[model samples]
Target: MDKIINSPYNINAVARVDSDNIVHNHIYHYCPIGRVDDNNFIYDNNNNVVGRVDDDGIVHNHSINNSPIGKVLENGFVIKENALVGRVDGDNLLLAGAAYLLLIQGNR
Candidate 1:
């Protein structure tokens, strides 16, 4: 089953996918960039390393530091710093799904 990541305000759809969104407006599909590691990497449709999400819900840029950019809390709240940024509708959303909303869609 696919999960739709809605805007924090609950107005627009940030992402619609199970692992990657396929909507026509969505130019990029968020998916696992490589082999599953300690941190799951998020890649765009073009296959570039976009960011990563850790088991603890820490979202990181594609860098060695994996600096904290945002977080996907256990309650399905997507946070940037300390602000509520997005929300996932439905359960069991994979790390990549949350990462795309915060790291990619949030920027748009």
Candidate 2:
């Protein structure tokens, strides 16, 4: 979790995945991406637990009132109840059929 703070690799905020968004040297195209706290927990605007990414590259599901919504494996495979849901792309975005951004909706 501490690595997230001093992330040697910067995961810069990007413009929303939209065609209108130009994929050039656009500097303003940024979203208030969620923060990974010291405790390694991500929360939504409603103060609801969203998810977590630990030092092991394991993304733990903390959604559903902090219940086990699912887990995103290091390989980006989302598993829920031992079933494969979907996978996360290079952009760290999941394309699950029932996908919902586990992060907060807007700027927190």
Candidate 3:
């Protein structure tokens, strides 16, 4: 679905982009994990299993057929496929790969 997630910077919302990689101005769903902990399951607006994060700070995207998107490093850098995506802010909010390859990519 062509989607765009307009979320608060700290909230870290994920969006499903279209074939052209454009994030349309629409929200399909958001980070079901309002507050993240460990082993949280990510979901779409349809409430389908999108992906998940492990306790070790690894991001796994089931939305793309069980793929390894990125991981949260010790320095609080959220790197996706070796590229610097985002990071955990002071409030410990994980923000990363929304509007790109994931709807939301983080420790959530």
Candidate 4:
């Protein structure tokens, strides 16, 4: 199954996560370092470990002292600093930092 990450208003697709757990947009692609599940580190196209999703659904940025950057709530909403930034459609992967990986760092 594939997960579609949409904008806050659910307008456009921000990124598409395929069955292999690889996230891809027109400009960039991010893949998991270990397994395709929780507690796994996410890497960018350059194979840099950008962030990670914890078991609690919290997204952490490795470059920023592993701070809690965002949260993937149980309701499928992606929250960043208490604001609705994006949403995941389909079975939640519980990837701690997938939204932050695609929305913020993926743009860099």
Candidate 5:
């Protein structure tokens, strides 16, 4: 059977992404108020929201997965392997494998 994932903010509403790696929009019955506590914004392997992130960078609330939400690094590149990774110098999320690899080349 297919697994059903629910957003921690809303049970009736669901989060949907427009493109595969582009725009991500969340549609729910009512707007979620309050801040997203890190502890409450955990996610699962299936990308389910198991927790939330508050105004401060604290993971107290419980959620699905504990993947680091928000910006992982500041003005640095996200390197997965030993390659040239894209630079995060701007306000855009770069998904280039090689580019991200290059960014963290000499950082280590």
Candidate 6:
């Protein structure tokens, strides 16, 4: 495992696989300077970010080989896999398959 501090606000870390030459994992940690409120972005052996842990401690995984599965909003909502979910006004909810649920509603 090799650690590299790319910037003051982010840390880029990588770990190599012993068996496969092309297999490696890259981690991107944000806001590692002061606050412990950091997020982890994980990549697969193919250099593709397959998952991410948000600041809210929600783990978002890829559907298929770096494909977006879902995201965790600031609010406490576990949007399960293959579900039409979104957020509105800081609230995360299911889109009901008819309406477009806003994942992150801006302060408007």
Q: Judged by lDDT, which candidate is best?
A: 4
Q: What is candidate 1's local distance difference test score?
A: 0.63
- Tens-place lDDT per residue, model 4, 11-105, is 57656667776766622444332223344677665667767878788888777888888888887778888877777777765653355443364
Which of the two, 3 or 6, has more lDDT? 3
Q: Whose TM-score is greatest here?
A: 4
Residue pairs in candidate 3 whose N, alpha carbon or C atoms collide under 3 angstroms:
14-103, 14-104, 15-103
- Angstrom error at residue 42, model 5: 8.6
Give the per-residue lDDT digits (tens) of candidate 3, residues 28-91: 3433322212335554445566666666767777767877777766665566767765544332
Full-model lDDT, candidate 4: 0.64
Candidate 5 per-residue lDDT, tens place, 17-103, comes to 122221121332222212211233333334544443333322222332444323223333333333322333323222221121222
Candidates 1 and 3 compared: the better one by TM-score is 1
TM-score of every candidate: 0.70, 0.36, 0.50, 0.75, 0.20, 0.26
lDDT per residue (tens digit) for residues 1-108 in model 6: 222211112332222222211222223222221111113445433454445545453444443454444544444233446442332221222211101011111111
Quantify all predictions' global Cα lDDT against the true fold: 0.63, 0.38, 0.46, 0.64, 0.27, 0.29
lDDT winner between candidates 3 and 5: 3
> Residue 99 deviation, candidate 3, in Å?
12
lDDT-best of 3 and 4: 4
Model 2, C-alpha of 15: deviation from truth (Å): 13
